[model samples]
Target: MDYTALTEAISSKSYEKIAEMCDDLMLQGSTEGVVNNEDWPYAIHLLGHIYVDDINSARFVWKNVPRVVKENRPEVTAAWKIGQRLWTRDYAGVYEAIREFNGSPEAQSLVDSFSEVYTKRMFQLLRSAYSTISIQETALFLGMNEEDATKYVLQQGWSVDPASTMFTVKKQAIVTEQKLDPSKLQRLTEYVFHLEH
Candidate 1:
């Protein structure tokens, strides 16, 4: 099956359609161990994550959640809010919300599910950054030279792209201009490499 195509279709679909698709897939036993399956459930979780981050999208998803998953609806909405705040770098606020949610038995499952989905995303990003094999290619993509690319990677201590192996000259230039620190680059490279094997 063309997973990329499938994911793209899912990503662009309406919240109602996505909910229906999820339900259909689940009925087909396609969601068994979804939390553990990196591709299927992970992709669905990503859709939910995107919805949570995008306000309009989240509302759509919330409106469409099937009755079977209705009990877990609020938690899903909460997860989206938590994720958006977290993505905006509001670590303190995110933590506080997480703490409050964690305290609630009703919210624990959803929170845990969000954590797993988020972790998987991080790993995927790390993998993308590490898989970049050529300094020139990386540099060009970031709009930097080899030296700057190395410096940025070493300094940023985080992976810029963790989903794909390809990087272009323009992207390299962007990375270089961003002036990623050497230490950060090293950390990101190390983390990404560790995942490669």
Candidate 2:
């Protein structure tokens, strides 16, 4: 039995190496080694994490991985769920998952690494919630000093208020069409074939 591609690696539970192999193989643009293997679920799970910060890449892999691979693979499913929330910038969910994994000594290092992303995502949420909020408040909230928080916000593409140390979020206007009832629609032009005057 040939166990070269993913199964043997997965059976060994050497996920970090599997992730590295997936990267090296993906760079070659030849998926002959990874796809259609019995361990497709595990491979996809590893691939998604390899591009954890890249939401589009993670989703693209998920789409390509197909629905059939998700069956009976709880770990793969959980990994996909994590990638999805990470992609959607769901910091709460991400942090929860990180905390859940933190209990395992083996996974602690990986959890710590993922926590960095959670920290980044928390700030993103903060930036999103406030259209214009005091930088000092942000600094206080994130436990950073004024200057560092200001620099961080600015680096994240938020504008600083000239009058004070405030982070001003520039949100795009949302335009939506009002729904009109069909019965209430006004007919501006109508041709009368036969009208009783």
lDDT of 2 by residue, 1-197 (tens): 23376555555555445555555555444445434544443434444254356556556656665566667555555556667667765545655555554222323444455556556665866756878889777775544678987887787778987688677875645799999866555332222322422
- Global CA lDDT of candidate 2, please? 0.57
**What TM-score fits each model?**
0.28, 0.43
Give Cα distance to truth, residue 125, candidate 1, Å: 0.3
Q: Please report the candidate that would top TM-score against the real structure.
A: 2
Weakest 10 consecutive residues of candidate 2 by summed lDDT: 188-197
lDDT of each: 0.47, 0.57
Model 2 clash count equals 0
Q: What is the per-residue lDDT of model 1 for residues 66-176, given as tens digits with 9 covering 90 to 100?
A: 554545445544555565565575544554555455323423544554455544443344436654445555454343456765566556443444345333212222343
TM-score of 1: 0.28
